[model samples]
Target: MAATRLWIAAAHDPAHRNGGWAFVRAGAGGETLGRAGGDRRTTRARMALAGLLAALEDLPPGEALAVVAPRPDALVLHTLLKPPAEPPAADADLRAALAKALGATTPATRTWTLAVGDPAGPTPAAFAAAWADLASDKAKAGGAFVHSIPRPNLAKVQGL
Candidate 1:
């Protein structure tokens, strides 16, 4: 099964119609497929033409699409992407791991990071569930939703 990672970076304005969305599709290995698009549908068509869309469409069961939208908390996101240790099972371990990963974003997000990373707090059963609430907020809709619209609000917590 193939996995698709799309970064739909567009001009900051929705009404501006800047024309052509710059897309970066991460596929097999480190191979990438980038294309220009006048609109969402056209961008998707280009992806299909490149065969990345078809690869994702044929993904096997249990291998669902993983979609992420850009968050307004640029600083926080910057922190999240920073180098972090390997994920650990315990919340306490996760906290330490996130501190390394998210601490760089901002001092404020650092506090929140420790809060959820606490093993005694909400005992998240898995990595995906740990930031489930935040993921929904970041996407501005449930994960089941096919697409998301960027918004000003950001999820208070994020899972690494």
Candidate 2:
């Protein structure tokens, strides 16, 4: 079977040590997934990895997929796709988890694709929703929330 293609995006607030992320499968009628969270201490990179890991965890084991994320993140992820020069450090645990997630999927094949676009352009709809959730979390004095809803239902919930 062919691999499924997904578009993913994330938002982070360094000062708050929190962020949100979202993903949508390519084409119409795919489900939209999103979540927001934070640690007392965390970096942008860690949050991005956390989002990707969450997406992976949500997938069925051995499901072949081609994950795509916006540019700068794609660059960071590409660096991670390489072997570490030295022993793992701060993000080591997350990286290890990412490895395990990939392992449970397709065997021996690359899985992510990064898209290059005008950063000034409007945020991808998925990312915008993520940002809204992040803001909501901040306002509530709590961290994050998760939801998996069909595209149309998600639209209604978001009041879009």
Candidate 3:
């Protein structure tokens, strides 16, 4: 059997040292086979990048991983081999990071969509909707399966 594709929606707030992530396994008709999220103890950019890279590396081969972050710098650094030495300005937006991460000519076969959302408010339904749409689109375009790895909730973080 072929490896499955994973769609990851992450809500990160560097200031609060907390974040939430949801993983979905994509299937025909944009169905989610599995889902999960939780808090990241270390909200530091480097830690976040390391955690994400570790998670992605642990996944089974052929499993395409897509991660969505409120800020794009984290995601860009995760994918680029020779990323800039300095960190992006704290205010940088997701679109800019995505554009930098995915330069021209790179086919977005198994990709991640970075959906920005408020870390202080209730989880945005729009983010979830975007994940669903992307997962469905990818499944249709690549004919690959998708699944979400289990994670923890950020809302439970103390003093959030």
Candidate 4:
């Protein structure tokens, strides 16, 4: 079997204090495939959006990668491409700009999955659970697992 490359990332909105993580996988077929996530306490909508964007941006060029989110509506993936003006006119405008940018290049057959968690105090179990939820949704969602260990506690937690 061919080796698969998967990229995972988490995002958080400092302002709202909400966030979540996402995982994207690129199979040998050159097709973007995977899911996103959204959770109640552990993962928030905004955080999930950030994680999804981070994952997509990290993907290698020309590599097929799919995104999955627990709450697809919360994340406006397209927004990352064409961000709002330097100083966005307003929150709504900024969001719209982001949406347009993210939606611009998306394929019609894109796949999405939803997961749950807390953006703030995300436990190792929560992260693992969310990853499993999204990966199981798609058969091709398999590859190297990349995760960012939060500072302070991350440094203290052994075997993370």
lDDT to native, each model: 0.29, 0.55, 0.39, 0.40
Candidates ranked by TM-score, best first?
Answer: 2, 3, 4, 1
**TM-score for predicted model 2 compared with the true structure:** 0.66
Which candidate, 1 or 4, has the higher TM-score? 4
> Which wins on lDDT, candidate 2 or candidate 3?
2
Can you give the lDDT of residue 62 in candidate 3?
35
Candidate 1 TM-score to native = 0.26
Q: State candidate 4's TM-score.
A: 0.32
Candidate 3 lDDT, 20-50, residue by residue in tens: 4434344323433434333433333433343
Compose the digit string of candidate 2's lDDT tens values, residues 81-135: 6655773576888887887777723475435444543334444444534553454
Model 4: lowest-lDDT 10 consecutive positions: 135-144
How many Å off is the CA of 139 in candidate 2?
8.0
* Alpha carbon deviation, residue 68, candidate 2 (Å): 2.3
Task: Determine the backbone clash count of candidate 3.
Answer: 12
On TM-score, the candidate that comes out on top is: 2
**RMSD in Å for candidate 2, one decimal?**
4.6
RMSD of 1: 18.8
By lDDT, is 2 or 4 better? 2
Question: Can you write out model 4's per-residue Cα lDDT over 73-114, one digit (the tens) per residue?
Answer: 224443343344563343444344334334444553223333
TM-score of each: 0.26, 0.66, 0.34, 0.32
Count of clashing residue pairs in every prediction: 1, 0, 12, 34
Error of 3 at 109 (Å): 15
Q: What RMSD does each model have against the real structure?
A: 18.8, 4.6, 13.2, 12.4
